[model samples]
Target chain A: MNAPLLKIDQLSASAGGAPVLHGVSLEVNAGEVHAIMGPNGSGKSTLAHVLAGRPGYVITGGTVRFDGADLLALPAEERARAGLFLGFQYPVEIPGVSNAYLLKAALNACRRQRGEQDIDAFDFLNLVRDKMRTMHIDEALLTRGVNEGFSGGEKKRNEILQMLVMEPRLALLDETDSGLDIDALKIVGRGINSLRAAERAVVVITHYQRLLDYVVPDQVHVLARGRIVRSGDRALALELERRGYDWLLEAAPAMA
Target chain B: MKALERILADFGSPADAGPARLAAAEALSTHALPTRRDENWRYANLRALEAVRTFLPGPAPSISPALPPALPGYSRLVFIDGRLQPQHSLPDTALLGSLRRSAAGSADAGPVPFAFSGDGRFGLIARMFAPEPIALRVAGSLALELISITTAQACGSYLELDLELAAHAQLELVERHLGGAGPTGLSCVQVDLQLAEQAQSTHTRLLQGAPDALHYDTVAVTVGAGAQYLLRQVSAGAQTARSTIQVRLSGREARTQIRALATAHEAQVCDALFTVLHEAPGTRSDQLFRGIASDRAHVACSADVQVSAGAPGARVVQSLRGLIDGAGAEVDLRPRLTINTDEVQAAHGATTGRLDEDLLFYLLARGLSPVEARSLLKWAFLAEALNAIDAPALRRAAGQGAAARLADTPATELLQ
Candidate 1:
């Protein structure tokens, strides 16, 4: 009876004058995690970026609605304040902004947007420390520049750390498990799973099914050639991991 | 012609000026003020100097300068306008004394090192009328602070500083220049430094001038064998300011490192020129400069590093970054390296760009507004240079001052 938390209808987008997503549609409800898996160059990351309002992507047609609001109309930062978060695949390395300072500024930004007072510096530090423990992040890294000179696994953990601090209503995690090791993947998965609640939703875009094993998805969709060619459940990801996408491509030769 | 007459009248007579001043004046008379054709003056136009030409020179301000927080076991010298304020300066010890009093019988009685340059009209002008310098010699590890103040009066002022460190000596020097509100003033400063064999020196300079004052500074240093010279500078708050720093590694294994940060706002212009020469084998130099401009401001940094023909194993590296935040904000960065030697390592990088879009989006996704995100990035761009400062207190103060200048730039909002 209630509208889905996110609904993408006939969304078509182009990057650098080349169309990447063509007539792709999907719906995600709260309290559920959806995984979109495909082979390389399947527009998985593009969908995440478009949803997060990244520039350089031209939307030719279709619409995206979040909580029944026209999500496409909001700016990137405004969308963030309205409870949308994106976990970058390759986290940006900012050489001068300390991790702790960034987290505090971001948390305060969200608080101000909700008409709430900012957290005190001491309290903010405690909050970050607790999250850092769960994320297996070093406290020393918090004093250094954001992701500057951080290892691949450390950068991924930082992305999740930020996600935990923001507690956004709708989160898009783009290949968060790509560069992470096995242990890091588990920690990141546990961190994401902890945020699962009745009022929040997540969309995980991954190429490998190993991530889906930790963060079990309620639904799995196969995207290829700018379109979603198949949709299934947990079993679907297992099948793709076993048989690869050749079977699906053979079935939809024209679109592939 | 009228300006020269006014200068001579204010200066009294060339007879009183020691040989250094006489020679400097003769050179100034022979070589005219630099024109646009001169490479050094190409980016800096001094038409405004003519406006303040008639402003007569006045006596040094007698007011006490505001002393900075003292470092433990350190020495200090305070100067107002160009004259040394002995009562306000630090207590004289065995290591520090007035140049006139100490140099009377020492081997240093001759002309000060690096005090004369043919291309410096302002340097020559400063030499003609400036009082004796406040000098300090470091025989052991020492920390010194030099404070120069310009009051509301004394519209045109000249000051000079001279330092000679003994062999194997170690010194850390901090220079602070404060200018109060004044009639269109011109403040000229010359620093002559020499580092004996195996000596080490770290120098930090902060220049905060009046909104409409003109500041001209020239510094020359020669490093001996196996010596090291490290200098960091931060300048702001002047309508027109120019600094020329020259260093020559005159002996084998000598090295120099220079890190400079400059900012300008509200129609101000700041220029920095650096020249480092490697004349001895195995000498090295590293130079980095960063500049930020907003609110119709202009900032420029130019550096040249030369490795002489026979100076093998010489190395030079340079990096420059500039950020332009508002309309009409101009930033120019030129890093030039000339290596005449076949076996030398020299490299340079210079870039002027706006905030990165991807970086902005990352910040935005974390819930920061467009303006907040932009402000953070802009501040970070300048903080990169500030962090290189070794003194924590100075670094903190410098970072805060840079932020105040950047507060006027409005946060950039998303186009959508």
Candidate 2:
């Protein structure tokens, strides 16, 4: 009866004047998780970046709607303030800004936008410490620069820690599990799982099915050549893992 | 050329002129001011100097000027218009007795007891016109604050500081140069530092002049065997500022560290030339400089390190970086290393670039406004050099000063 929380209709995008995504469509409803698995250069990351309003990407056709508003019209920061979070595949290292300072500033910015007062210092510290424990992050990293000199696993964990703090309405994760190890993947999965609620939606983009073992998405879609060629339940991920992308590429042109 | 001639004509040798003062004036009579053709003076804004009408010392203010709050555990000395204000100074009698305010170019102190290698013309000017050169000798642990304030006078102001540390002594010195409300004026400063064997000295200098002022300074230092010298400098004011610094590792195993930051905006020009000579075996030096130019400003830093044949097993490291924030702004960084000996380790790099776009986008993606993001990144870039300061009070003061220059909101919070 209710419209999907996010709706993408015939969305086509290009990067550097080269077409990357062609006529892609998808819908995600609140209280549900969707997994997008694709081979290299299949445009999975492009779709997520386009939805987040990243610079350097042009929407060639169609539209994206988030919470009944035209998402493509907003800037990156405005989209962020409107409760959209993107977990970058490779997080940036900012050497001079402390992790705590950035987290507090971001949280305060969001709160101010919602007509709420700044979070009390004491409360902010407590919340960060609790999330750090859940994400298995060291307490000392809080005072260090944002992901400065962090190991690959540590960077992923920090991204999850930030997501846990912001608690956005919709989270688009771009290969967040690529460099994570078994233990780190579990911690990150648990962090994302905690954000699952009746009013929140999640879209996980990845190359493998291992992350699905922990988060367990409700639906899985196979994207080939910028188009979803197959859709199924969680069993679809297992089938792809067993058969490999060669079988899909053989059948992709027919489906297109 | 006319400015130099005018300065020489205006200087009718005074009654207090000593042999050194006479020699300096005589040298200036025949020596010509350096032009853009000179290698070391190429980036200097010499046009500003040619516009000066008078080279006479600014008259000392009759009333004591307001001073910044004193740092904890540090004795304070105030100088207004090149004249020492003893009433405003709170010096420990025993240690303060060594600070002598001699006559202008007093020869009894003996030609600084150190060799001079920086631009001799400016040193000559200070030697010829400075009211009195303050010489201080330290034989034990002490912390001292020297504040020099230039008033609203149209004439030039000059000061020469002579500091010597005895063997095995420790000293912490904080020097501040501030400009009183005024129009454009010239401030020429010369500092000479000599450290004995096994001695240690930490020097911090802050230059905050008026927006329309001209400032030129030359600092020469000699480090003795097993001695350590550390200098941290921050320049954030003046329409045109230039500094030339040279350090000679005269004794074996001497060590030196120099860190500097220059922030220029709005048609300002800041230039610095730093040189370190390893003359003895096993001497080491590390230098780092960071500069930011915004809104049509220009910033330049040239760092040179040289190892002599006598200095085998020497170590040298130099890192110079500059950031430009506006289309018309310009920053230049040059790192030079010349080694004539074997078995030496030297690394040098220089880079000038705009702010990293990825870093900016990272902040924006977190909901920060464009201005806030830019301010934070700029503060962070300058903080890299400020973080090396060991003194908390000095670091805090430098951070606040830098934040104010960046127009960063809530200076206290930014520093924290």
lDDT of 1 by residue, A1-256 (tens): 7899999999999999898999899999999899999888889999998988998999989999999999999888888888889999999999878898889878888888899998987899899999999999989999899999999999999999999998899889999999888999999999999899999999999989999879999999998877899999999999999999988877754531
Interface Cα RMSD per model, in Å? 1.0, 0.9
Query: Candidate 1: misplaced stretches above 4 Å?
Result: A246-256, B1-12, B62-73, B92-119, B152-154, B407-416
Q: Write the per-residue lDDT of candidate 2 for residues B1-416, one digit (tens) a residue.
A: 58778788778868778887787777767666778788878888988887777889877678657788889889988877777888988888865788876577767644642223335477777777888788888888889988888773678888888888999988898888888866748888878888999999998988887788888887888899999999999988888988888888999999999989998888989999888999999999999999988889889998989899999989999999998977899898878899999999988888899888778777777888778888888877887788887778778777766555553443256675
Tell me how each candidate scores on DockQ against the true complex: 0.74, 0.75
lDDT of 1 at B226: 98
The digit string of per-residue lDDT tens for model 1 on B275-333 reads 89899999999998888888888889889888998689998889999988768999998
* lDDT, residue B37, candidate 2: 87
Top of the candidates by DockQ? 2
